[model samples]
Target: MSVTRRVQNTVRALLGLTLAAVPGTAAAAAAPEADDSPTSASAGLRDPARKEIAMRLVSSAENSSLEWRKQYRYIEDIGDGRGYTAGIIGFCSGTGDMLELVEHYSSAKPGNVLEKYLPALRKVNGSDSHRGLGSAFVRDWEKAADDRDFREAQDHERDRVYFDPAVRRAQQDGLGALGQFVYYDAMVMHGAGGPDGFDAIRRAALEKAASPARGGDQGTYLNAFLDVRRKTMKREAAHEDTSRIDTAQRDFVRAGNFDLRTPLTWKVYGDGYRVD
Candidate 1:
C-alpha cells in the first residue's frame, strides 16, 4: 500500500476506526489563515462560535420520554451498546473538519507562511484560542467499543497521531459547519433542518444510499440511532418509564451490527458524497 494508505491503515488499527468512515469535514470550502496561538497570536486570532446546542436538549427529550433520571454518560452507554454513539457537537468528529478553518472570516489570510500544511497545525481543539474545539476533540466516549479506558495503546495512537497537527488553522468554522450539517441531517428526519435548501440534501442522501453509491455499510448506524430514538420515544411514552425505554433501545441496538455503534468516528459522513 502507499505511505498515506499505510498511515491510514495504521490509524484504523490503532484507533479502531475506518477511514472510509472518518474522512472529516465532508465538502467544506478552502480554509483561511489559522488563529492566534501564543506562538502565532494576533496573526491567527480571528475566531468564532457555531450554532449548535450541546446534546443537553436531546438528552432532556430522552429523559422526558422515559420520565426517569439517569446520568448522561450512562444513557450514552445505553445508546452506544445498542449500536449508536450520540454526543454533543464539540467532539462529534463531523465538526472536527474545522481544523482546516484556522480563522473566523472565510476570506481572512495571514502573512506569507513557511510551509504547505504548517498552517493547519497552528490551532487544535483544546488550544487557548479554541472556543469549542476541546469538547469537539475530547469526549467521555464511555469506552473503546464500550470500555471508556483512555489508557490503552490504541487511545494513545489515536490522540497523538490520528488527530496530529495536520493543519494550522482553527477548526471552529469547520466544526460549526459540521455541527450544522449533522443538525440539518437530523432535522430532515424530524421534518425541519435550517432554512429550505437542505431538504434537497436529505433527498439526495436517501437516493444515494439506495443506489450503487452505497458505501461501506452505508446508513446503518445512523439509521439505527434514529430507530432506537424513535422507539425509545414511543416505548417510554407508553409505559411512562425512562429506564424501560433505555433498556428496550439497547436490546434493539444489540441485535444490529454492533460495530455500527463504534464511537471512534473514522468515517467522514460526507465521504464520497457526489450530491450537489
Candidate 2:
C-alpha cells in the first residue's frame, strides 16, 4: 500500500482500538498518565513542562532563541517557495493556514491591521507570491502580534493545525511526550498528515521498528523515527542541517527520556540549551 494509505489505515486502526471494548488492547494499554509533574493532567505533550520544552526546541530551530514568545512578530519570505513564513510556528502564507490565522484574529478583534490584506492573502494562498503584500503587511503583522487576541489566535491555530494532531497520533501509537514532540516538530517543519509529510516519516519509522502500541520499546522506536526524520531533512537544502534530530531528540532518546522529563539539555544548530 502507498504510504498515505498506510497512514490512514494506521489512524483508523488506532481509532478503532480506542473505541473497541477489548481487554488489554492497544487503546487500553496506551492510556496517558495522570498529572504529577508541572505538565497537564492528560495524555500526550500538552502539559506545561513538555510544551515549554517543545517551544524551546522549535525556537532553537526557527529563531535560534529559547524565548519562543518573542517570535510572534517574526515574518519573512525565506525564498523557500513557501511565502511569508511567519509567527511562532512559521505559518506559511502560501499554505492558506496563515490566512486562516488572520481570519481567526480578525474575528476576535475586528478591523485588525491584517484585515485589509484579506484579498491579497486569498490570492497568495498556495503560491509563492507577495503580490498584494509588502512592507505594510509586515508592519501590520508585527503590530498585530502585540495584541493578546492575535497571539492567542496564532497559538490556537498552531495547536489546531499541527500540535494536536501530532500528539494524538503519538498517543494512539503508545508514544510519550518525546515521541509526541517528535511528531509535532515534524508537522511544524513539514505540514502535517500529507503523503510526503509527517505521516510518511512515521510510516517509514514503523517499517524499521515497532511502535509502543504494537508492543515495542518506546526509545528504540523513537530512535528509528528520528533516523527517518534526519534522512528526510537531508533531502532538502533548507532542512539539510540534521542536528536538531541528531543532537537534540536523539540525545533525549539515548538518555532513555521517553517521557520527555525536565532538566533537559541539548544542542540545535550547534548551540547549547538547557530546560528545567
Candidate 3:
C-alpha cells in the first residue's frame, strides 16, 4: 500500500480502538493524586506557551528534514512582504493545507474520514520540516522499510498521539503544535530510539483513542493555522487602501534583502494557497 494509504489504515484502526484507549479518570475524581489530578495547563489555551512554541517550530526548520523542503517547497518564502505567516505556523499551515485532504471534514458525518485521520494529521505538524516525514516525527519508521512490526509501531503512535487523544485535545482546547510536537519526544522517553520505544508511543496513542474521554462524538480538530491565516487576510483586507498597500510593500529596499514582516493584500491569501 502507498504511504498515504497506510496512514489511512492506521487511522481506521484508531477509530476501531477508540473505546480501549481512554484512561480511567474516575480514579482521579474519587481520590486525586499529584500527577493524577492533572494541571490546568493541560486543558487550556496558553498563549505565552503557544507563541514560544511557534517560534521554536519556525526556527527548527534550519535543522529539519530536507524532504519537507521539497514537498512544501513554498514554505521557505514566509515573511518579507510576501508568503503566508512565517515560522512554525507557516509550516503548520503548509502541511495541513498541502496534503490530499481527508474526507467529510466539517463535523458533518459519522464516518467522516477527515474527522477520522485529522487528529493525527494535524498533530504531525510540530516538525522542523517534513523531509523525513514519518521518521522525522516517528523514530524508527521508514517509508522505505519492509518490516511489518516496525511499521506497525510507528503507525500506532501516529494514530495514538495525532489521531486520538493529543490532537483531539488540541482541537477542542485550541492548542496547536505544542502538544503534537511532544509525541515524538514522548516516544523518545520510552525504552529508547529502538523499535520498542517507538512502539510504546504507538500503543499509548491507541490506548488514548480507545478511552472514553472522546465520547464517540467523532469530531476532529483541524490545525487552525490556516483559519488564523484566513483571519489575518481579513484583517489585512480592512487595512488595504491600494496607495498604502503599494507604499507599505515597497517602502524602499536594501537591494536584495527581505523585509520579514511583509504586508500582503487580501487577494494574496487566495493566490498563495492556490500556489501554496
Candidate 4:
C-alpha cells in the first residue's frame, strides 16, 4: 500500500482499538428528535441536517463558498496576527496550532512532507513571524492536503480544537442548532479557548442577556451573542467585515431558523447562496 494509505489504515486501526478498549462506549445513543421550538428540551445540532447547515454557514463566512471540504489546502497570512492560517479551520502556524497539526500528521506518517518543517514550525510557535518558514512551507502545506492521512488529521484537529468545545458549550447553554452554529463560527474566527477568545465574547453576551439555559428567549440570546461577536470582529483589522453576522446568521434568526432547518439561503461578503 502507499504510504498515505498505510497511515490512514493505521489511524483507523488505532481509533478502533481505542474505542474497543473502552467499556460501554462502543455505541452512541440514538439522537433526539428535531424540534424548532425555542424552548424545546431536545435542542441540539447533533442531527445530520443541522450539522450540514452549520457547516455550510461557516463555509459561507470563512471560504465564501459552501464547499468547506475543499478548504483543506487553504493557506495564507491574510494580515492576521496569527501567521500562516491554513487547513480546514484556519490553523495558524504562529500560534503553535499548525505545529501541533503537523506533529499529529507526522506521528501518523513519518517522513511526510510536513515532517521536515517541524523545527521551523516549533520555532515560529506563539508569534506571528515567518522568519523560520519560507515559501517552501506554504507549498508543502498545500501538497500535504492531497494525502488522506493529512486531511483526516486536519478534520480531527478542527473538531478537537474548535467544533466540539463550541458545540458542547452551546448544548450546555440550552441552545438549538442555530446557537450552536453561532458558537462554532465564532470559535473558528476567534481563538477557540483563550482569555480574549470565544468564551470571553460569550461571557460578555451573557452579561447583557441570559442564555437559553437561564430561561432567556433563544432569539434574544442569539442576537446578544451576535452583537458581541460583531463588536469583537470590528476590534480586529483582519475581521472587520460584519456581514457574516449581520447578513448570514442574523438572517436565519429573522427567519426563525433556530433549528437551522434547511431550504436555507444567506449571504456573506455580498455573495449569496442557497442550501436546500
Count of clashing residue pairs in every prediction: 29, 2, 19, 0
Candidate achieving higher lDDT, 3 or 4: 4
- The TM-score of predicted model 2 comes to 0.84
Please give the ranking of all candidate structures by TM-score, highest first, separated by commas.
Answer: 2, 4, 3, 1
In candidate 1, what are the lDDT values of residues 8-59, reduced to their tens digit?
Answer: 1121111122212123322222222443344322222111111111121122
In order, the Cα lDDT scores of the candidates are 0.25, 0.74, 0.26, 0.72
Q: What is the C-alpha RMSD of each candidate to the true structure, in Å?
A: 21.4, 12.0, 21.9, 11.5
Error of 2 at 268 (Å): 0.9
Show where candidate 3 strays beyond 4 Å. Answer: 1-48, 54-58, 61-96, 99-180, 184-201, 204-276
For candidate 4, lDDT tens digit of each residue in 119-200? 9888888877897677898898889999999999998887788788999999999888888888988888776567558989
- Write model 2 residue lDDT over 29-107, tens digit each, in one string: 1223343754442545887666877877667666665667877887888777888888888888898789999988888
Worst 10 residues of 3 by lDDT: 267-276
Best by TM-score: 2
* Cand. 3 TM to true fold: 0.20
Specify the highest-lDDT model's number: 2
TM-score of each: 0.19, 0.84, 0.20, 0.82
Full-model lDDT, candidate 1: 0.25
How do these models rank on lDDT, best leading?
A: 2, 4, 3, 1
Residue-level lDDT for 225 in candidate 3: 24
